[model samples]
Target: MKHLSRLNKYFLKYKWWIIPGSIFVVISNIFGVVPAQVIGYAVDLITENVHVYNLFSGFNRQEIVYDIFSSNLLYFGLLVVLLYILRGLFLFFMRQTIILMSRHIEFDMKNDIYQHYQKLSLGFYRRNNTGDLMNRATEDVNRVRMYVGPAIMYTINTFVLSVLIIWSMFDVNSKLAIYCLLPLPFLVIIIYYVNTLIFKKSGKIQERLSDLSSFVQERFSGIRIIKSYVREDYTRNMFEIQSNEYKKDSMSLVKVSALFYPTMLLLIGLSTILTIYIGGMQVINGNITAGNIAEFIIYITQLTFPVTMLGWVTSLVQRAAASQKRINEFLDIPPDIQSKSNDETEINGHIRFENVSFTYPDTGIQALKNVSFEIKSGEFVAIIGKTGSGKSTMANLMMRMYDVEQGQITVDGQPIKALNLKNYRGQIGFVPQEVFLFSDTIKNNIAFGLDQVTDDEVFDAAKNASVYHNIIDFDEKFETMLGERGITLSGGQKQRVSIARALIKSPKILIFDDCLSAVDTKTEEDILQNLGKIMQGRITILIAHRISTIKNADKILVLDDGKIIEQGTHNELLSLNGAYTDLYNNQLLEEETKGI
Candidate 1:
C-alpha cells in the first residue's frame, strides 16, 4: 500500500477520468440490481394469477388469463431489457474513462523510467543488470496497469453491487439476509491467508523471469563467441536449466491463482443453499410470502458475481503491490551525478587536473592516484602507458564520467563540477578505445554528435577519419544502415566511423582513447595528418600504446600503475634512462622485426 502511494500523483493527474468513471459505476450497478427485482416481481405476479384462476375460474379462464397477464408481463420484460441496455451503456463509459486513464498512466510511467535511466551515472548501470531493469519497465509496469484498470474497475463494481444487494436483502428480512451472507466472513479470512502466499510467489516469479530474460539476452549477444568455442550443446543445456527454473516458479504462482475460482464457487454455493433453505422455512411459517423467497433468491444471485470477484481482486492488489515495490526501488534513487550550475560554462581551451584521484565505484580499484596535468589550447598532448596503467582513466575523469575523489579538475580555472554537466560534456568529443555505434545510416553515425549537420560536414568528418572511401563503396553508400552496434562494418571501419562521430562535433576539447588501434599504418598516419590540420585551436589528448603514434606530440606523459612516471617531449623522454625509454625501444624493435 505504501509503495502504491507513489502512483497517487498520477491519479491526481487523471482525476477527471476517475470521477466520471465512479459515477458510471454507481449508476450502472443501480440498474443492475433493478432487473433482478423485476424478475422476482414477475415470478410473484404469475404465481398469484395461477392461484386465483385455479380457485375461482371456469372453462373460459385461458382467454382471461392471457388478457390480464399478457400486458403486465410484456411491460415488465421490456422494462427489464431497457434497464440492462442502460447498464451496458454506462459500463462502456466506465471502461472508457478508467481503462483509458490507466493506459495514459502506463505511457507516462514508462517515459519517466527511461528518462531516469538516461540521467543515472555509469555506476548505477554497473550495480543493476539490463534484464532486471527491462523487466521492471515492461512486465512490472504491465502488472501495475492491471491493478489500475481491470482490478480497480471490478473492485468498485463488486463493492457497489454487493452493498446494494445486501441492503435490499436485509430490508425484506434481516434474519434471512444473515443466513444468506453467513459465508462472507469466511471469504475475508481466506483472502487474508492466501494474499501473503500470492504476494510472495508473485515476487519470486518476477525475479525468475528477470533472470531468464537476462540469460537469453546475454546468450544472443555473445552468440558468435559461443559458436566459435563450439559450446552450443553446453549453452543449450544451460538455457534449459534456467528455463525450467522459470517454469517452476511460474507454475507455483499459477497454482496459487487457480485456487481462487474453486474456493469462490464453494463459498457462493454455500450462500445460495443457505438463502434457499432459510427462505423456504420463512415462507412455510407465514413470516414472509413465497414472493419474498423468490426475491431473497434473486438477491443472492445478484451478489454471486461480485463475491466471486473478491478473490480475483485480492490477488491483483497483492501482485500490483509487489511490482510497484520493485519499481520504486529504482525510482527512489536520485542520480548522484547532477549539474549544480544552471548556466553553461564558457570554454577557454585550458584544462587542469590538480592532484586529482579517483577509484571505480563498482570495484573500488583506484584507477588514478594524485594525478595532475594541464593542457593548453592548440597542444597535441599524448599519454603512453601499458594496459591498466590509468591512461584511459584520465580521459574518463576529464569527461567527468566519475567525479574525482580528491582534489579537483578545472576547465578554464573553474572547478569542473561548477559547470553545467551537460554543457561541459557537450564541449568535449571523446572516442573511447571500445567503439560503439548505433544501428543507423553511415551519414547519421558520423554526424551523431550534432542535432543538425550538413552533408558536406559529415563527408568531411568521414574523410578525416579515413572511412569515407569504405562507406562510399557500399551499395547504399551513406544511407546504408548497419546492424546492431554497427556489426555490419569491419573492426577498423567501425573504429574510424566512431572517430568520425567525434570529429564531426568540432569540439573545443578532443580525447581519442586509442581508437585507431585497428586501422592499418597508412590509414592511421592519414588520419593523424588530418587531425593535425584540425588541431589548430583545440586541446587534443591522445591515449596511445604505440610509440610511433605519439613520437611527434608536443607533450607526452608516461603512466605506470596508476601514476605518471615521466612527462616531457618525445625526444626528451628518450634522453632519460627510464620506463618510457625502455617502452619506446621495445615497440621500435617490434616494428623493425615485423619488417615495417
Candidate 2:
C-alpha cells in the first residue's frame, strides 16, 4: 500500500475522469437496484390478485382477474428492463471515463521510465541485467495499469453496490437483513488472508518471471553458439527446467486462488440460505410479506457478484504494487555521471591528460596509472599497447565515459567534466573496437549520428571509409537493410560502416580505436588516404597494434602494463630498439614471409 500510495499524483492528474466515473458508479448502482423493488411490487400485486380470484369461482370473474394481473406484470417488466438499460448506459460512460484515463497514465509512465533509463550511466547498466530492466519497464508497467484500470474500477463498483444493496435490505426488514449479512465478516477474514498470501507470492512470481525472461533472452542472443557447440538439447533442457519452476510457482498461486472463489461461493450460499429460511419464518409470523422475502433474496443476489470480486481485485493490487516497487527502484536512481555545468564550450585541438589514474568500479581492476599525454593542434597521434595496457582506457577517458581518480583531463584549458556532456561528446567522432550497427538500411546506418543527412553526404562518408563500392554493388544499394547487429555484412564491411558513421559526424577530434583491424592493409591505406583530404585542422588519435597502421603517424606512444614506456616518432621508436621496435620487426617478418 505504501508503494501504491506513491501513485497519488496520477490519481490527482486524472481526477476529473475519476470523480465523474465515481458518480456514474453510484448512479448506475442506483438504477441497477431499482428493478428488485419493481419485481417485489409485481409479486405482491399478483398474490393479491390470485387471492381475490380464489374467493370468486365464476369463470368470467377469474378471467377478469387474470387480465388485471397480466397487465400489471407487463408494466413492472417494462420498468425493470428500462432500469437495466439505464444502468448499462452509465456503465459504458463509466468505462469511457475511467478506463481511458488509465491508458493515458500507462503511456506517460512508460515514457517516463524509458526516458530515465536513457539518463543512467554505463555503471548502472553493468550492475543490472537486461531482463530485470525490461521486466520493470514492460511487464511491470503493464501490471500497474491493471491496478489503475480494472482493479480500482471494480473496487469502487463493489463498494457502491454493496452499500446500496445492504442499506435497502435493512430498510425493508432489519432483523432479516442482519441474518443474511452474518456470513460477511467471515468473508472479510478470508479476503484478508488471501491478500496476505497473494502479496507475498506475487513478488516472488515476478522475480522468477524476470529470471525466466533473462535466461531466454540471453540464450536466444547466443543461439548461434549453442548450435556451434551442438548443445541445442542441453539448452532445451535448461529452458525446460526454468519453465517447470515457473509452472510450479504459478500453480501454487493458482491453488491459493482456487480456494478463494469456492470459499466465497460457500459464504454467499450461506447468505442466500439465511435470507430464505429466516425471511420465510418472518413471513409466517406476519412480520414481513413473502414478497419482501423475494425482494431480500434479489438484493442479496445483486450483491453476490460484487462481493465475489473482492479477491480478484486484491490480487491485482498486490501484483501491481510489487511491480511498481521494482519500477520505482530504477526511477529513483540518479545517474553516476552527469555534466556539472551547462556550458557548451567549444573544444579546441588542445587536449591534455595530467597524471591520470583510474580503476573499473565493477571489477576493482586498475586500468590506468599516471598516464599523461597531450595532443596539440592537428596532431595525428597513435597509441600502441598490448591487451590490458590501457589503450582503450585512454579512449574512454577522452570520451568522459568515466572520470579519472587521481588527476584531471582538460579540453582547451578547461576541466572536461565541467563541459556540457552532450555538447562535449557531440564534437568527438569515436569508433570503438567492438563495432555495433542497428538493424537498419545501410544509408541510415552511415548517417546515424546526424538528425538529417543527404544521400550525397552518406555516399561521401562511405567513400571516405573505402566501402562505397561495396555498398553500391548491393541489389538495394543504400536501401539494403542489415539483420541484427548488421550480421548480413561481413566483418570488414561492418567495420567500414562503423567508420563511416563516425566520419559523417564531421568531428573536431577523431578517435579510431583499432577499428581498422578487420580490413587488409590495402583497404586500410585507401581509407587513410581518403581521410587525409579532410583531416586538416582536426586532431586525430589512432589506437592500433599493427606497426604498418601507425608507421606514418606524427608520433607514437608505446604502453606497457598501465604506464607509457616509450614515446617518439616512427623512426625514433625504431632507433630506440625497444618494445615498439620488437613489435614492428615481428609484424614485418610475418608480412615478408607471406610474400606481401
Candidate 3:
C-alpha cells in the first residue's frame, strides 16, 4: 500500500489517460463474460427445442434443429469476433498509457534522486560505493517502473475480474459459487506466507546483486593495475566467487517463484473440481438448469485464473516492495553537513582558523587538533608538510567537505557556515594532486562549471596554465576528446588541464594542492611564476614539498602531525633552522649531488 501511495502523484498526473484506460479494462472484462453466458443460453435453447431463427422472429416451434444450430452459431461467432476486437483495442491503449506514465515517473524519480545525491555531503559518497549508487539509480529505479507499468495494471485487472466473476456466479447458482470459493481462505493464507518469504529473500538477492556489480565494476576500472601486478588469476577467482554467490541468491529467488504458481494451480484445480462435481449434481437433480451449470463452470474457471494471477501479482508486489525499501533507505540518509544560511554573500577571501579541531567520523582518530591560522586577502601563502601532516584536511575544511567540531572557520569576517554553501564554494577553486577529467572535449573540460564563459577566455586560461600550445597542436585542437580520466594525456598534461580548469573559474581564493608534482621542474617553475603574477591581488595557497615552490611566498607554514610546527617567510623559516631548514637542506644536497 505504501509503495502504491508513493506512486500516487504520478498516477494522478496521468489520470486523464488512466481513468479511460481503466474504464476500457472494465468494459472489456464485462464483454469478456458474454461468451460464457451465450454458450449457456445456446445449450438451454437446444435442450428446450426452441427455434433460434425465423430470421429474427420470435421463437418458432416448427423450425428444424439444423436451422437453430446454424443461426445461433452464426450469432455467437459474430459476438465473439466483436468482443475480441474490443478487448484487443482496450488492451492496446491500456498498455500504451501505463507504459508512457511509468516512463515519465521513472525519469522524474531518477532525476530527483540524482539531484538529491548532488546536494548530499561528500561523506555520503565517501561511505557508499560507486557501483551500489549506480545500481540504486539505474536497476532499482527500473524495477519500480516495471511494477508501475505492468504489475500494477495486472493486479488491478485480477481484482476487478475476480469480483465480477464471483458476483455473476452467485447470481447464476449461489450454492455452487459457495462451493467453488471454499478454498479461498486457505489460498489467501498460503499467499500471505509466500509473500513474506519472497520479500525477505528478494531484498537479500538485490543486495547481493549490488555487491556483485560493485566487484565487477571495481575490477574493470582497475584492470590495468591488476595486469601490471600479474594478479589476473587472483582477480578472476575473486570475481568468480562473487558471480557464483549472485547466481546462488538469484536461484534461491527462483526456487520461491517456481513453487508459487504450482501451489496456486493446485488450489485452483481443487476449487474447479469441487464446483464441477457439486454443480453437476445440482443439474442432475433438476435444482439448476443446464444453462446455469454451463455458466457456473465458466465462472469457476475464470475464478481460478484470478487466483493464479493473484499469486503472481503478490510476487511482483513483494519484489517491488523490497526494492522500494532499499531506495527509501538511501533517500532517508540526511547529509552530514548542513548549511546555516541560504543567502549568497560577497567574499574578500580573508581566511581564518581559530583553535580548530576535527576527527574523522569513521575513524575516531583526530586528523587536526588546535590548528590556528590567519591569511589576509591578496596574500600568497604556502603550506609545507610531510605525509600525514593534515595539509589536505585544511584544504578540505576550506571547501567545507567536512565541518569542524570545536572551532569556526571564517571568510572575510563571516563564519563560513552562515554563508550560502554554493556561493562560498564558487569563490574558491581547487587543483588536487590527482587530476580528474571527464572523457569529453578539452574545451568542455577546461570550461567546466562556468555557465557562459567566452571561448577567448577559455583559451586565455589554458595559455596561463601552459597547456594552450599542446591543445592547439592536437589534430582536433580544443575539440579533442580526452579518454577516461584524461588517460590519453600525460600526467603532466592532465595536471596542466586541471590547472587550466581551476584558473578559468577566476575564483577569489586559489588552492593548488601538490598539483605540480608530476611536471618537470622547469615547467613547474614557469607555471608557478605565471600563476603568482596572475594571483597578485588574490589569496593563493600552495601546498608543496619542493622548497623552490614556496621560496617566494609571502608566508610559509610548516605542519607536522596536524600541528603547525613553524611559520615565517622563506628566509625567516630558513634562519630558524627547524623542520623547514632540515627539508630544504636535504633537497639542496640532493640537487648538488645530481649536479656533481
Model 1 TM-score (2 dp): 0.98
Top lDDT prediction, candidate number: 2
- RMSD of candidate 1 to the truth, in angstroms, is 1.4
Clash list (residue pairs), candidate 2: none
Q: After TM-score superposition, what is the CA distance of residue 405 in candidate 1 from its true location, in Å? A: 1.1
Q: Where does model 2 exceed 4 Å of error?
A: 59-62, 593-596
Clashes of each: 0, 0, 0
Q: Which ranges of candidate 1 are over 4 A from the true structure?
A: 59-62
RMSD of 3: 2.9
Cα distance off (Å), candidate 2, residue 123: 1.5
TM-score to true structure, per model: 0.98, 0.96, 0.94
* Model 1 residue 267 distance off true place after TM-score fit, in angstroms: 0.7
lDDT of 3 at 72: 76
Q: How many residue pairs clash in model 3?
A: 0
- Model 3 residue runs over 4 Å out of place are 1-18, 49-65
* Model 2 C-alpha lDDT per residue in residues 216-243, reported as the tens digit of each score: 9888878889999999999899999998
**lDDT (Cα, tens digit) per residue for candidate 1, span 1-596:** 88889889998999999999999999999999888778778888988878766765666876687678888899999999999999999999999999999999999999999999888888899888888999999999999998888888999999999999988888888999898888889888888898999999888888888888888888887888999999999999999999999899888878877887788788888988887888899888988777778777777777778877878888888899999999998998998788888896658668898898889988989988998888888889999999999998899888888788899998888888888888988988999998998988988888889999999999999999999999999999999999888899999999999999999988889999998799888999999999999867788999999988888899999998899889999889989979989998898799889995
